[model samples]
Target: MILYIEQEILLDTQCQDLYLCNNGLNNEYLLISSSNQCSCKKVQAIFCKYDHDSCKNRCLLEEHLLIKRKKQTNSILINDSPANVVLLNKNELEKNSEIVFICHENNLPSPILEHLKNLINDRSNATPNPSLHQTLIGNFLLKHSVLAQSAYGMYLKLQQTRDNKFQLRRHANIGYLLANILLGFLCSFILYRNFDLYQLISNEILIQTENLTTSIKSIIEWLMHAPAGLKLNQPLVDFLARFYFYHIYLWSGYLEVLVVTVVPYFYKILFILCLLGISLAIGAICDFIRLLTIHLYCFYIYAARLFNWQIRLLIILFRLFCGKKQNPLRNNRLDSHLCDIDQLFIVTLSFTIFLFLLPSIFMYYAVFTSIWTITILTVKLIQSMNQFLLQIPIYEFYLWSTGSGIIRGTPRLSINYADSTEDTVCYNFNFDPVSFITLYRVCNIRLSLFSLSFSKLFLGILKGKSIV
Candidate 1:
């Protein structure tokens, strides 16, 4: 069997012959070659020996070389003295490789070498291909419409205000921002034109606020008694229920007054927001809604604080019961302690009271927390929609779809082998349009209002930290 292997050799003026020797590994050979006598037959023999185990057919060997000459040397000459026999692994050969042009004359023509150098430099500095969306749209337009082709040609001749990718992105962002502002104005005008619709929306908001207050009051009353078939401390439940009821009553009264006085002028406030931008306007609306329902957030805060306080007291009392006290000098680590009888009695009493009251407090906390979370999520969804509108690249998408090269991304290089001769090679260079998807991925802010981990949120609530 015969084997095939590929290898690179470095040739210079001083080297002449080549030799192949096995390096005592599986199918690996070290080639020791000089410039003068390196030929096809010797390379094939080396390959056959390298793959002797698996192949019994003919072998093939191909060699590619790029050489560089010193400025002082004009002609190739063979050295009579033993050429330097430096053994190189693949990595060393790659590291020491240099590019040079071989010619029939002693020296290569300066024009040809300079042209090759220019090509290499141009290739290295060329822009990358356009984004995926741009390419797809560009191709579709180019394939189907002659009118699009003419328009694109005209667009290409027009001087570009945005000459680079960064400028293009900035221009697109400004366009989107202006578009959002215009949309906000349109929305505000529509609301202004339909006064009845605005009145209807205002009434609905007031109605929703009233309903929420009533639902919360009902929930508090139900919790005041035994809830979910669980026996709770009546005194503690009564205190919490009365506290929440008073706050809800105050909030409802405030809403009632606002409905009569402020609801009629709510569109004026929205029109002021619309002057800013659609995203800001929408975000303001969300904030306004949250403000109207602020009572729920207040209830959650009260319950969380009460629950957290009881839990902390219970933990300290538990440690005291276990005959341990936290030592301030030892970074608060628990240490063994013999408690006084009076202290022990107080600890036991406190722990029992806190433990009994915990269930009632916890139930309120959980209910209010869930409601607040849902409200926050709804607000975040609206805000995300606003953000999407503010960043969407509508203008760029239209330009790309019409085959306008103004939205070009990286320049693409294609080799035209059909145009190449023995003495010359040809290359074609064109710019691809930047994709909208790529821009969105890079520039769009994440839509989430809260990206907290579940464990972190749970711990925060337990510690009486406000999630908002």
Candidate 2:
């Protein structure tokens, strides 16, 4: 268990030994050599006081020298040829001096010892430690055994921590998906049962088909006047008019569906909306995970492309004559033109008021049609709270979705609108998350074909305005 080392080995004087000094004083041992520092220095001069024990004394001296020599052989000089540090075995250490230099190296606590035991035999209950020596075979086995034990304990603790975090993340994703599915089913059921609810409420004043057609015509007329209206300094009117007409047209179609269809037909529409909402919710979750999985992917694709908090804000301000750039340069005119296009989109989307302006109508439709959207949207927003004990206000979550200045994209995922520099402001609202998301992004490709055709028709008008 211990190693001995010596400074040097050399014969000295003042060594005294005696043997058969039987009866009448046979012989006397005498000490020789050395000055006052006799205790510190090696002694010399052995006396063969007795003949019988003379050989024994010589043997003892030789054995002592042999052990010391072994230690000296193992001792390495710092600047020696090999220059590598070598560990000493029992023989090498025993040859060293009685005083040995001890350095203790420590290991971290872990659970890997349990892993090792399980690997060897499934039925074995013994947990091994990293510091524990499984194959004890030498004089230093006791020391190594303790080290192995400590290592195994450390491994177990680390494994448990990793497992817990993974479980928590999985549960959160599952909760999100479950809520969406329930909402989708509920919405479809409601729509299937109450087809004529909207018609009954509006007292036929808003005949679904006729009203929707009239709204679309009015919106097209308003769109024709948008650019000129922007130039005439009637930009706000131009914006609101276009916004209102478009949303009314869209929602009116939902209302019209009830009178024109049977239970199955209305159910089909509800089913579609529910499906779209669920898809949006799923995409939102996927986007969140992808955002965390890769750093650059989060910034470029999700944050910049989908959310677009900065781009949308700049466009809004430029349309309102309050853009960031002062004294716009001729060279940067293209940038200003792009802002104008964004402003138009913003105006058109705001018309529905993100389902807020038409909440009564939407809720009636949902109550009568797909009631699941409200439930899904509501629960999802509530679940986004950072802490379970302190739930964030549901109204606050709603404001984040339907409120102006809240940029829309996917459900339960909205960001406060920011200027071109991405500076946060509390003034006017900019985008509607629900309408843009459920209407544009989540809908099928066929739905988009209709929208693109509508956009092209509007674009043709804009081109005509430019020529004039």
Candidate 3:
């Protein structure tokens, strides 16, 4: 079934035996008297060269030619043309010979895979090399962001493949997200009944609804002093920031409720673990969900013109009821200064930039929890260990501040704070991961949004400075 693609044969890729090969690899130089496959001098000047780089280019050119031939004629030509194609051997290698494949080797045409089962499926059940797995998993995790991924996540990322599929696939994101969401709901239900023991000790004052409303009012008032010529949609900015805060506050409130209830020490520990898991799951789902939400928001904003009178009426009524200010840029067609499509594009770009810089809060929480718990236990062990272990601090904690420098920062997220008067700035690390997550989220969005001052002022509405 060897597809010695010497003659101009359109790849009726219906056959699995079809493969592309070149005569140049079998010889030091490739020569062609026929001009049907491009001119001989064109081949002599470049294609015939005994260089790996040149051969790669030649193979590409050959594939291109084959594709072109396929288009001109749909049938695979069976005549012998000019080729010294060798056998499909992986082991045979010349001093500088290399093979290039244009087709997807993992997934041949349906019938073809069946025919080449012996050749392709031979390594199906073979155990992957431990070192190779380690190398790949290590590189992938480090490349993405190590602080945001748990050890179990790392294991799944390194798991063996099925049906010879690639280790890297985009669909995995969808499944990972769905699993997290499902797990969150499951935990919520399970905790509701069997988990009555989460209450421990907490009497701290949580942010009240009245406080949130006051903050919003003050924030809007402070925006007037924002840099002039800023084109921010003040209402939108305030809304987004408030919404982000609300989500954080919701999670914090739940945690607060849990802390105030009474529970045993073992249940308390179990609750902490479950709490961390839920947070991590939420963090994992955030990226994809956020991306999706952004697009949906953009779609709504950009596609407002498509809405009939009923939807438009509802929106107008809702705005009136909520006391929303009339947007000067409102338009049924293009916006006052920006088209809907253009605005959507700009929104997407800004969101993408922000997302890239923001660290996963849940992942960070998991790591922090693990480290804090380990430190608590390890310190006790150190007290009994030899002098080497005794040298380390036990039953204590330390504090440090971050400066406005690239190499230094509290969360290491950013150094561009609104107030830069302080020589060194240290953020308070909250005992509650939820509260800390709130702070982290605020800092990241604020810094990132400000950094985009040169771009759109979409979120620059700060008529009041009293929000904090």
Candidate 4:
């Protein structure tokens, strides 16, 4: 059978008697051609001519051809004859165009076509199944590997479609900011009106301050004795104890004055902070804690400076003993030098004195260093928590959870083979909910700031720099 589909209608070259029949009900035109008797009685060959002009109406023609072909196919099947089904593009039929055969149905009962279709179907529907080993190792790598996270992040970024407009995000941010401001004002108003609540807070601060002062005094006295059952030079220990105790007394006197003066106005300061924002108020509280522990910080600095100075002198004396001197003109590089017997004696004596004094200096440095570190970490932890609260996208998460369409993600396409037959396939499109990982990355939190490097901390302390 030979078929020519055109804009108006077309006639077969062999059988010019073919007629064009238009169905009045559906307003569709069908070309009805008479079958020609051929030499191959069992085999039927069909030829089709498609034009560029009719390409726009390909869907309609395709449907009509399928219906007509089905009817002829049923008859051929009844007769147990061989047949072939082919679809060609208009470009392929033109001069210098390539000839392509879409499908060839033979009566030899070949399973190649069925096998190929099954393979394609299975591939399309395949889901990943990781082995137990792979699952465990992959999870570990993902958590600990920076490269893995970066690669996954890049893959997600590529999957996401670019959308420059951020009206929804902007609106959400504005709403959150307004809500925060309103809540801050309400809190400030409540605190300002409630006198007893602020008075209690003030009393609590004074009590904590007094307790801190008493604790410091007791710790100093304990150290003056053999702390941790270690023997120490009594005269040096007593001198250091008296030094710390004097500072503690001074700090206590200062706190006593502050309790009568500045501490009474603590609530007023809190009210002012609350008016700014809850996050600001939290930050202010952290700052207040640091301020209260300023004496500890000062003690740490003094101990670190004294220890570093002693260390520097001992290093110089050791170099003198090694017959080497630091060349100040050459960036403090070591240079060989011959020292006299007198110089050697003086270097050895100084080195011994400094080394013996190191135990007392180290003891004070360690104690104050620990106290300062604890105070700093507590303040930093509070600040980090405040920052996390401020940066978290709670509103966005709520919108996504509610399916409000405010948060959009990439749409995934799925093929629905249930509605599909041998001739046509159906496609379904849907969108998956945005992942929490994506939301977290969007926030860009600086978690690395909290990461500690012990080497860097030790170097900084040796260099007489502030650790905090």
Candidate 5:
């Protein structure tokens, strides 16, 4: 029997040709299997270090476990738990799904096994559950939502298993990516801080300030000796020069004074706070711009369908004649375009147009990109500080026995002889990290919506766009 394979064109050559069993008869199986393997050479190399059994067993095992976990996860009774798992992040979903691990415990008392299930059934409805973010860390021992939910699911599976509790724990990679990002951010900041970028900005501003001050002094001298008729005729230029000299002088000199004079004295307290605020504001502005641009891109895509006829016609015309076929490198007319355009031509055209129009965007883009990079460094530093210096334990439920309550012999369960430890109990666990991620994401979205509404209200009032 023949097999049919369907795939779209890839823009990059890095992940194109690498595959196992290039002409195997089991083409379907190969396709299914290879879908799970990393196409990137770098990722495969990383995978090879820990993946024994020639990566075959690991790849096969990953698919088998993920499928079983998905079945188990879907079979779960949503009505009983009613965990609202809202998935907004693509990375979180993929990463969390790949992290399903199985754990088993044998030789346990019946009550202990049963109690474990009960613990899983009960969620922490505690009032003081806190976020571990450095900006929002509280006094309470806050468990990460993913970890907490995983523990809960594991407890539930333990009760359902036939012999013993078999736990499926999905915590793949275990925050290594986030940790690496934090590390990289730190390294970049250390390198950048050594470069003294802020000193450069301050210095540049000082030089311009000095030059402008000198020019203003010359202008004033020229004006002092000039005729009243010429001064009247050039009153606008005189006013602007004087106004700019005072205004720009204050802005340029203040930072210089702060950095050159008072910063050494109050570096830790006042100056640092000022810098941090300025940095945060700049980062937030950059992020806002990025978000807005992305929103506009989405809007542009939808505008093809949603916009009025005149606008729609213009967009379609631009897209249709983008002329992907014009490239001599292209083999056929069917060869796809880059984002619906001829990449080489569009890029050159965009560069030309950017130079002529909206060049301010490019100027701000470079400055903000650097500032945001530093802000990310600050964020990483804060996250690391919280992780290292601050010890926030994951809150867990523990059982205690009372001295007054006397207990009889331990409870036991009779099973088949094949199942050894007949008078013993066992436990199974299944921890679905996805559920906790979804829950946290949902809460975060709600929080974001609330904050957005509040900010919009405040901004409207400030702009005199709404009720006082």
Candidate 6:
């Protein structure tokens, strides 16, 4: 195998030649080789050595003398040179190295300096040039550090700006949410009280009854004034009379009863009122809770967010329980405005303090009026039921009991004949006060229909046709 050996020549004084072997330590030889011939007298006093390891014994000169001779020859060539300019940057200053040529024609030209400029430019164009800028070389690696610091500063500023924007948005959302909750609370409170119940019941009874009566009266008077004299059934006349009397009496009696009984028993009445009162309060609270939830369904003009329909339904139901119609206003605006719970409480309190608060001396009489109205209605219902039983006669088996009677399902599964024999049965339904009101309302409707139908039939017979 053959080995490739490389060697380099440098102008250091201690060594003439330095050789590098791929697998061996460096070797120095004390032989001085030059391209030009050397004169013997020029560096003869300097000691010389020609110590190539192959010729170490043959040469007698010292290594330092040969190095000095070689350097002097190179110096002669450099000092005798006619280069006009030299590269003075780091490597060039140290080793007098060449750089790329720039022609004198490319700069200012003078004939006296032309030859020197050409020689300098030629030498500059040679290979193995030196760098002229030392500071740039020393500082090149620090560029990335400055850039990284600038980037980090910008990032911190952006982060702070984003955080501030987020805080502002959160604050605005909280304010809007709070405002909505307060508004819902106010609206729901108004819906709780039934301000229009009494007005509605009274107006409905008066208007409808008057219309019905006037229609009946017109028919009766027309028949009475007919050219031919007429006759009608006696029992039909009696039924008509009884029906008219009962409903009219009951209509008038309701006011007296509510005024006398409910005013005195204000605590019990207040309880009934508060049932809807606080329920609406709860609905308002539910709306507030729902506002915070992601679902926005409860917040709107026609919905729970604006006015909860559930509370309105409850108020209507409670009024029906108190024997009143769902609609109590002739004027639509009054119905909407006056039906609110805040209005109801105001009216109820005002009436309680001002109208119903007469002296105790007249208090018993007021209560007596309520009891008398109840007695009249009860008697009319019993009389109607008796008339019904006489006609239908199938429910004679229904046994009588107190207010605690079982009512919903089949209640008479096991009844002994001995316990069942009684001329009149008394069944009490007192659990819900509304049950009594509903019972009476049913009786009133039946009595009114029976009376109107019988009256029309009687008048038809009297006129011999077309009474309705």
Question: Residue by residue across 1-468, what tens digits does model 1's lDDT show?
Answer: 101111233333232223343223333333433211222122223212122322222222233111111232211111111111222223321111111211111232222223223322323222333232278787575333322332332232121212322334345556666677788789878766875676687688778888888888898888877899889889888888888888988998888777667766776777776765666567657666766767778888887777778788888899999999899999998899888999999999989988988888889988998888788667656755765665677656665578654444343445546533343333333334456664444323232222436687678866766666
Positional deviation of residue 73's Cα in model 4 after best superposition, in angstroms: 21
lDDT of 3 by residue, 232-302 (tens): 44554455446544644554555444434522443444344344444343333332233322322332222
Give candidate 3 misplaced runs (Cα > 4 Å): 1-83, 87-214, 217-468
Expressed as tens digits, the lDDT of each residue in 67-92 for candidate 2 is 11112233221111111111212222
Question: Candidate 5 on 381-451: residue-level lDDT in tens?
Answer: 44333232111111100001221111111222332233123222211212222333322221111111001
- What is the lDDT of every predicted structure here? 0.53, 0.30, 0.30, 0.52, 0.29, 0.28
Candidate 6 lDDT by residue in tens digits, 1-468 = 111111112223342332111111222111122211212112211221222343332222433222222232221111122111111112211111111112123332122123223233233222221121235632342221222222222232233333422222223223323333344345444433554454554455456545644553453333333213434333433443354345445544553454444433443333343343322233222222222221111111112211223334444544533445444455422222234676566545654443222222122222223333343344334434422321221111121123323211111112223312132111211111123332222111121111225565444333223211
TM-scores for all predictions: 0.59, 0.20, 0.21, 0.59, 0.23, 0.15
Best-to-worst ranking by TM-score: 1, 4, 5, 3, 2, 6
Model 4: how far is 342 from its true place, Å?
A: 1.6
List model 4 lDDT by residue over 24-52, tens digit each: 32222222222121111111222223222
How far off is residue 231 in model 4, in Å? 2.7
Residue 79 shift from truth in candidate 2, angstroms: 23
In candidate 1, residue 4 scores what lDDT? 12
State, as a TM-score between 0 and 1, how close model 3 is to the true structure: 0.21
Show how many residue pairs clash in every candidate, following the order shown: 14, 39, 12, 0, 11, 11
Provide the lowest-lDDT 10-residue window in model 1: 75-84
